[model samples]
Target: MKILWIDDEIDLLKPFIYLLQQEGYEVETATSGEDGVELARREVFDLIFLDEIMPGVDGLEVLRKIKNENSQQIVVMVTKSEEEDLMKKAYGSWVDDYITKPFSFNQLLSVLNRTLKRRSIISEQMAEEYATQFRTFSEPADYLEWVDYYKSIVSWDLRLLDYGSNDLKVLQKEKKHEANAGFAKYIENNYRDFLNGKGPTLSNNLFAYAVLPVLKEGPVHFVLFDSMRLDQYYKLSNSLREFFEINTEFYYSILPTATPYSRNSLFSGLLPLEILQKFPQYWSFEEKGQNRFEKELFAELLKKHNLRIKYSYYKLSSIQDIERSINSIVNDKADIVITVINFFDLLLHSIPGRGDMKGVLDDERVLLNLLGYWFPLSPIFEIFKRLSKKQRRIILTTDHGFIRVRKPTIIYGGRSISPNLRYKYGPALRVDNKTALLLNNPGDISLPYEDPSVRFAIAKEDYYFIYPTKPTEYEKEFKFTFQHGGISMEEMILPYAIMNPR
Candidate 1:
């Protein structure tokens, strides 16, 4: 790739240029910012390394000019001043990276290489690496250990995604789809055992294992944001690392990874049916009103566990609520604080409602882009930092993750059937028997029974449920909308992280 280096001390940087050239990079030099801008305009260099201090048209001015000309150009600020205020000013001008003066040639080369080679290196290297191991672990018969393999593949996929390598991303996606197909077969065979408590930790066992121990340590703050996919979790988890050492673990969300059930089960520490039976008052199957509180099941869980500490539960549905929650936490010292932010979940559901969002988050890559823009600046993160300052232990997790629905499956159900693209809850619902995890007895899975004949069915993989009455219409409407409550790694695998103030 071509790199343009602009510096008044360009002659002194001969060693750096030679090292980069030896590394196979096209090194172009300009003695002044004006010359650098001319070269940039004349040629399409991949990146520009501009010195902050220059005789005429200083780095900041040059940066402003470059951005005005082509905002997409990648520019790194090289500065002799290590002053915090100057660094901040350079960053504020939108430079990709800042390099201090007197830096080693190796460090300079490393930064340049990372910036230019991130995509190519990750794409080619990761694809080749995963391809070899893919064969060794592709067997469907080895279901017992598939979870780890699946997680490994997902971890790589997320890594490549972060690396922003489109080619490797596509390759990893295809591989992951292949793994998911095999995983579907495995789940079909073993799901019954898992739900029946004859196997590993499924949805029912997630909270008991993940949350209870943390609670015992001190106070446990569980933030169960809905529809937080694993990749998004990876992005947000990076921020938490500053204050919390993450002991990351995953659990399989029950078939329907949707909020009403999956999130309820997570907070209540009981399956859907058990929640209804245990807390009928809080459990509402009503079509209208905030079905979220379904019951004050969370409060009951703490009570049942005999874990008594001052705790607060806040649901942030609006920007105002988020600000308020952050403001409140800044002053108070609650033992535990559980805040559920619905922005991601709302974003998913709203994708179908709003044409713009649907167009933006059309795929996983786009979805991650959207997430990267929002999560770090999110009110939850702001509150987290404030809480960290108070030296409080924190646990940030999600109810379930989301998947971009591609294939649509038509199902015939009565008018009484609940209309959810990822899952269906009604009697006389007709679906492909093999494609869904059908819960004939909701009671067994601890899900509430809406009717005496009510049953729950969740779509698997990238599939979403559509009614036969308006098959084509619904298919067109919900094709690319993000939905949950199905069986896929994105939906089922949940993230649990514990953090203590650094």
Candidate 2:
């Protein structure tokens, strides 16, 4: 490992340098910040040790310049003074490690071992450990243990953060798919029982079970991002730590992880059959701009419970809309706010299948990185950032998650059917053993249908339903794009998180 030590008192660090060299590290020493900057620009360094008190150029300025050159350069600040402001500045500049003046030589060695081995020498052991643990992840005792399976997958994903796209991580993705196959079967068997409160939380009961009762305590801000996966939430959770203490849990999405079902169920606190029976005018099949009655559904739920409070609901589609409405709506006196942000779902649909998306959003990790980057820069992020100052209780979650569809399965259906690519519903739907579930009658699973002959078929694993008429054309369009409304871990398992002000 190549390490650079920049200190005005270069003679004082000779013992530390000798120890590091004996430990098989190449050490380069600089007597001044100017010399250090020149050396850093000239050569690559695995790590940099910076002195807080310097003569000509101070430590903060050197830290700024080094970060300006390479933002990801690992820096450690060694300081004698215990000024809170100075330590904060060092930390804000992305210092990887910090040490006090009187810290033991062994302490410095411990820091070095932790920081350096994360990049090298630990991959073999981590891979072997994951290989053994993969067997445990593959088996689940029941439907509840499926949540544990999802947690295990998230654990593996977290461990692979510093090391992206390694072979072990790749194998973990396959194992995740394997685990999802098991979860799909589990949901097929006991989804209805769970909906009746048998096991893990489901999408239909989120409002009644999780949100409304919590609202009895204080005002809450609920933000829903459509079509965001559980793994994607983990990617974005690290960023939330700066503003709030996040508490996350897993829940299963209702079948047909699509918006009209899962999102509507969330707002109404009832299944589709119940919604159709209660408010017949609310149900509409508008695909692109569906769930138009969510505001009404929220109102109905509040009124059903005979509770009254100030609240606001928004379904924001554009960044401009978010910017325009956020200021006015947040300023209003309200006990609760529900905002449905549509950027993540839209990006998934519009990006993939375009010829230029080969390197941009070709897989799960790349697409997730793109989406996670957008979350912090989003106007909603800025709004929540302002809310954080007020110590508002913010609930961050999604209506449903999405799965990347790989294999194409043929489905023979009627002239007009449900437009979801992952599943199809119509009268006399002809589909066989490749189904996640075959609902012979829609009412049995709480699905709404005017005709009793109408049945539903959801795709299993990574399959997307392709029509017999245009097999090749449909394959060209949506062979590997992210989709929901089906059965899979990424689609059904959800991240339900709450952020309390820190």
Query: Quick one: best lDDT, which candidate?
Result: 2
lDDT by residue for model 1 (1-502), tens? 8889999899999988898889888989999887887676545677899999899788998886665444446788998788989878887877877788889987897777676665465457766776687666646464346657766876786666434356766777787777766777777777767777766666556667876777677765667676677767776675466566777776777766777777777777777777777777767787555246723776787788786777777777876777766777565556667777786855444343566665566656556545544554567668877778877777777777877788888777677888778888898777886667777787765667767788778788888888777789989988877787788777776666777778
* Model 2 per-residue lDDT tens digits across residues 170-242: 7877887787777778778887787677877777778767787779989998889888877677766655666
lDDT of 2: 0.78
Model 2 per-residue lDDT at 253: 82
True-structure RMSD for candidate 1: 8.4
Give the TM-score comparing model 2 with the true structure, all chains together. 0.79
| Alpha-carbon runs more than 4 Å astray in model 1 | 1-123, 140-144, 162-168, 202-205, 289-295, 345-356
Candidate lDDT values, in order:
0.72, 0.78
Compute each candidate's TM-score over C-alphas: 0.75, 0.79
